[model samples]
Target: MCGTELTIEQSGIPEAIPVEFCYAGWQESLQLLALLTEPEIPDQA
Candidate 1:
């Protein structure tokens, strides 16, 4: 009931896939948001 809205789309695949996902609580929702919004760090040689 309380969460953010997400839209997903995929292409170049042989079959259609399910795009919608619902989190059971705020903790799970926030965790997902953090993963998505956070930037990735590049590896150093």
Candidate 2:
């Protein structure tokens, strides 16, 4: 099995939250990689 991880901390957050974004296939994996880079995608609500 394959595994990966991405850790990040928000502006006011103290500890780095571990985001276990698992991917099923290569196409999905690529998408995850892209997301991992941009850790600052502010929510638009």
Candidate 3:
């Protein structure tokens, strides 16, 4: 199993919110791995 944490801010809000996400099972693990390993493209502006 794998887990991730995130903090998000809402418009007009003074504080950030904490969020947690977890992935389990074989399929979910694969998906999580793909997301973590995906390549990022550079901006060519």
Q: List the global CA lDDT of all models.
A: 0.59, 0.55, 0.54
Candidate 1 lDDT score relative to the true structure:
0.59
Write model 1 residue lDDT over 1-45, tens digit each, in one string: 955686644455444533332223445877788899877999998
User: For model 1, how many clashes?
Assistant: 0
TM-score of each: 0.41, 0.30, 0.34
Output the lDDT of residue 44, model 1.
92
lDDT tens digits, residue span 1-45, model 3: 665555534344233532232223444766787788877889999
Q: Which sections of candidate 2 miss by over 4 Å?
A: 1-24, 39-45
lDDT of 2 by residue, 1-45 (tens): 646675534354334543332223444866878788656868999
Instruction: State each model's C-alpha RMSD to the native.
Output: 11.6, 15.0, 13.6
How many steric overlaps does candidate 3 have?
A: 0
Worst 10 residues of 1 by lDDT: 15-24
Candidates ranked by lDDT = 1, 2, 3
